[model samples]
Each structure stands twice: as structure tokens, then as C-alpha cells.
Target chain A: MQVEFWFEFASTYSYPAAMRIQSLAAARGVTVAWRSFLLGPIFQQQGWNDSPFNVFPVKGRYMWRDMERICEGLDLSLRRPTRFPRNGLLAARVVCSHADEPWIPDFVRGVYSANFAEDAEISDPAVISRCLETVGQDAAAILAAAQMPASKQKLKAQTAEAMERGIFGAPSFLVGSELFWGNDRLEQALDWAARAAR
Target chain B: MQVEFWFEFASTYSYPAAMRIQSLAAARGVTVAWRSFLLGPIFQQQGWNDSPFNVFPVKGRYMWRDMERICEGLDLSLRRPTRFPRNGLLAARVVCSHADEPWIPDFVRGVYSANFAEDAEISDPAVISRCLETVGQDAAAILAAAQMPASKQKLKAQTAEAMERGIFGAPSFLVGSELFWGNDRLEQALDWAARAAR
Candidate 1:
């Protein structure tokens, strides 16, 4: 069967989960449906003007260090960003535009690495265009597509669906109606999907 | 080579960590210094009157499920308590009283199992008295000690130290000045302590 991989481009935990989910799911003979959406709107509903990490400084500090150890164990490279919870509006919009593209996985990883590993500004159109080019996709066409009203609506709808499904955080995996949150829970979500399929 | 394991008795993840940490640390020949403290003061500092799980409903739902899966994976039984984030004051004070006892580990595990696995009320003195008795400790003496001003100060000091160490949550492990938060990071914390010893 399939698991819906819900992720936000700006989420720190989503970085590692995005990098390895494909291979891990493949190992379990399970298909992953990548669902990229905005965490901004969800956080807004929770009375947060910015990321909760910024709202809670202590938790924020713990999260960064946790990311360091987590990335090290996963063999993934991570660099501390100058900006806290960099805006992913442009990148997320572009991702939603090409949700069905075959090159999407590579595109997704590119955006994540660019933001987390390279410490680049993902909100910039130029940076997002580079992410598009890296995946062998036409930068101009996809970037152009992402700006369309229909694409904007798609992102909004998916984000709304995320809330409907009780997704409060990024890197959540949906197994049937069960929502498993966090990058750490990826394996369990896949296992749940595999067992259900059997 | 030792790691300070700082945990709040009310924490759900701490339940599993407390049960397995001793054996896990012994395998690596690492000594664990268990520090029981209350999260109430810390949470209040963050402008929260309750656990973050309760502050955020969606996260709360996800956490309960996550705990279920985590417990199952660890081969431990878990029951959803009628009350969540139950008052851990009594439990914490009692744990602090037996900080140097050889039976503290088993006593701590029994208390956690009683709350999370058996869904018992840990806030009640009767329940805590039972936990002390299970470890073959003098319940009357230990409980009496927990009620003392000196014992209360000990719990307070450890909790204050946790905050000073930048510990925002649990079960956090500190190897010297470095802090590792979460039950998932338990092995990594022990590894850090072991590596530093070499």
C-alpha cells in the first residue's frame, strides 16, 4: 500500500526524513506519496506569529542540538542557518506545482539540502529556480506554474487537508486514517502501512 | 564516564526510558546518574500551565499514538491513563529521597509502570508508598524523608540545574555540559559519555 508523507520545506526534522524516506519505504515494498504543504497557516491557527521554535526558546535550543546529533547518525550533512525557520513560501509553492512529477523526489531533496545543508534562502525565487534545474525539470516552466492561481489553490487545499487530518507538525506520515507525527516516527508509519497492506 | 539522566515523573517518554536505561547503560559500561525533577516549574517559565502535549491538541493526539507504538516496540505494556500529565510532585519528591539507594532504579521503574502501564494514580501517597515497598525499601522512612524540607530542596536543585544546563524537556541526558533531549537520544547520550571516557 501507500503512506502519505506530509512535509513542510522549512521543517528541520523534515530534512532528514525527506532524504531517506524513499529508500526506506522502498525497502519495505511500500510506496510513499509525498505531500508538501505550508506549516505557516497551521502555526497561525495555533496563535503563533512564527515557528513555535522561536516562540519557545528553550525548546528551540534543544531542537537545534537534537538536529545535529540526528543528522550525524543519519549520515546527513547539516549547517546552522543564519535565519531562524527560513521562509519556505516560494519553494513550497513550487513543490506543490510539480507534485506529480517523476523528478519531484530529487527536487524535494534539493530544496531541503539547499536550505539546511547549504544555509541558502529558500524563499528566493532564484534559489528555488536552481532547485528546479537540478532535478532535470524546466526551471522557467515549473516556477511559472507555481505562480498560477490554480497552483496557489492546490497548496492551500493540501494544507487545509493536513489540518483536517490532524497534522500539527511536518514530516508526518499518514497510514490510512492514523497520523504519525515527526521524522522519528517514519519507520513506524511505514511498518504500519506494510502490515495493513498485508 | 557518566551521564545525568534528568526526567520528570509526569513525562510519558520518560516512562520507557526509565525502564530500560539501566540495562542499556550497563551494556556500554556507562554509569547513569538518574535525576528526578518536576517539569511544573519549567513549564510555568515557558508560560505554560500544563504539558505541551495538552497545550497543543493535535500534538497531544499524535503523542498518545506515538507512545503506544513506542511502548509496543520496546515490548512494554502501556495504558492510556484516565488523567494525562498527572501530578508528579509526590513521585518526584519520593524519587529524590532515594537518590542514592541501590533499589531506586527498580523503584523508579515500578512507579512509572504503575502510572503508564497500569494506569494508576501516582499523585496519591498510597500509590507511591506501594512503589517504595515493592523495591523492598522502608516505605514509611522514604516517604517521611520525601516530606522533609531538605528532600524538597534536593529535587528543586536538580530541576534548577536542569534549567541551567538548558534542558527544556525529558528524558534529557547530560554528559558534562552537552545536553541530549528525548528518550530517542538516550543511546546517543550514553555513547557520548562512553566516547569521552576513552
Candidate 2:
């Protein structure tokens, strides 16, 4: 099945998913198309200017605990990032530049780890540069390319596309035309992908 | 710490929680006050008119698998009931009538087992009668009383109260005025309860 993993670099849950999607999809004999987009515009469209976690405390607390349990079960390391939802503009731009390469998965995972595992301030240029260096890419050139007007326009267009596709959150898996939201939907998304492959 | 366990007899996830809440809470030096309520009205108010598990196929499939994983991990038995959501009306009423009894936990467990473990149609009067009998209750009288006008009104009022309290789903736990929804939120709820007690 042809599956597209639409993710935002700043989302907490998306870190675990972005780290695993490549291996999980490969095991099912399915190919994944990585799509990097921003959720800020989507949240704005919903009449909210921030993540729901910031809006609701009790639910937010539960979400953190739930993520802890899930990450432990999956044997993934997790550290509460100092700055949640750090700006993904540079990260998104790098992914967009390599939209046609198989290296997109590695790039996504690198960004997620840098933000979530290292607790780096992803909005800062130094943090993003470090992420690029870890992924064996030229940080200086990548940063320059990421700042180009064309790259900024591309990121905006992708966000607009996501909104039009009825995607309201990150870690959304698109199988053919079906959109499955949330990390909890990961297994079901795989099932749909397998069935589609058949 | 004193905790209120708001449960619906027909809820799939509530079975394991109902069976374990008392023991788990007691082990933690906490007391649980069992509160029986119906989820039908809540579903109706949300424009679902049915459980989200039944309304959304993809979500429903994931829930069944997720429930199995959770129950297995918790060392609990789970079977897909013959009826999706048995009319929990009679069961809720019986529970309400015995709300003052300390044996209410056992009754809730029995009802959950009958519906989720035995694949019984909980909405059916016969199934409920058998469940009550197993719990040593006067099935005939209790069943009759469960359907009485007063019992029916109590059920309606309880559901209304849940809505007034901003409860959108089950199994919800309230510590002070804070509402924590879903079984996944159990740990956070307990933590909040502990802190509140302190």
C-alpha cells in the first residue's frame, strides 16, 4: 500500500511515530511517503492559536504520562523538551528541499530526536544546524536554502494543502485518500495500508 | 484519599477498571466511591446516538485490539459482547439502588463480567436477571425496581448531572472539580487524587 506519513516536527507524540514509521511500514512491505507540514496554521483555522495541551491542563498532564508509558513500552528514550512545539519552519524547509529523496525519513527522525531527546530549542538556528550536522548534511548551505523565499512559500503551501485535506493534527497517516489521525491510530493505519496493498 | 469511580455497565473498558479500581485504590491507601451512570444520553447529546466504537469502523477495530492488549496485560478476561452496548438502563438502576452498599463493587464486577466475559446481551432483561442472581440479589424484585419510575428518573437525572459537570465520555474520574476522561487517564487521576488528599 502507498502510505504518506504527514507529520509536524514540533509535535510530542509525532516523535515516537516519526522514529518508527519507516521500520514499521517496511516490515509490512509497504512504502511510506514522508510529508512534513506545520500544524500552527491548522490550529489557527480551528479558532485556536495553540496546542490543545496548552489549553487544557488535566488532559495535558494525562497525555504526558500516557506518552511516557507508551515510549517505555516501545523502548524509546524520551526527555521532556525545554521548549515544546519549537518552530518547525527550518526543519520543514529542509524536508521540503529533499521531498524527492529517500533520506526524508532519516531527516524527520533526526529533527524529532534533536528536539525531544536533547531538549534543544528547535526554533533557534543553532539547534536546527546541529540537527542537520547529525544527519550528515551541510548545515550552513541547508540553513541558507531553508531561508530562501521559495522555501518559505513552499512550507506555507504545504500547510494550506494539509488544511484542505481535513488534517487537523500531526502524526496523521494517509492511506490512499483515507486520513487516520493520532498515534493511537498507527496500527489501524498499517492494517488499512496492508489491505490496500492486497 | 476518596475517589469517585463514574462507570457505565455497558462500557467495554469499564469492566477491567471496575474489577480493579477498589483493590488498586485500597492498595494505595485510597477509597473509591462507585457511581453508576448511563452513557446513552451522553452519546445522544454528542450527536453520536451510539458508541464511537460502533460509529467509526477504523476506530472500532483499533479499540477491540487495544482492549485485548490492555486486558491481557492487566490479567483480565475480555470477550466481545454479542450486543454492542446493552441497554445499561436496568443495570445502572440496580446499581443506583444499591449505591449505599459496600458490595456495590462486586455487583459492578459481576455485571461487567457477564456482558464482556460471557458475551451476554446486557440490554436483555434475562441476561441482567442472571447477573443479579449470581451476585445473590433478588433478581425479580431488583429487576422490577430497576425499571420503576423513580429508578428511571434517577438514571435520567444522573446522566444530566454528568453533562452539567462537563463530562463527555467514560470512564471518567473526578478529583475535586477536575474531570479526567478515559481509562488511559487512570494514573493521572490517581495522582491528582493523591495530591488533592494531601
Off by over 4 Å in 1: none
Q: Which interface RMSD values do the candidates have, in the order shown? A: 1.3, 6.6
The lDDT per prediction is: 0.88, 0.78
TM-score of 2: 0.63
Off by over 4 Å in 2: A1-198
Report the C-alpha lDDT of model 2 over A38-79, residue by residue, as the tens digit: 988777754457776765443466667667767887898889
Q: Which pairs of residues collide in model 2?
A: none
Clash number for every model? 0, 0
Model 1 docking grade: medium
- Expressed as tens digits, the lDDT of each residue in A79-186 for candidate 1 is 998897888877778777777778888999999999999999998889989988887778888788888999889899999999999999888999889888889788
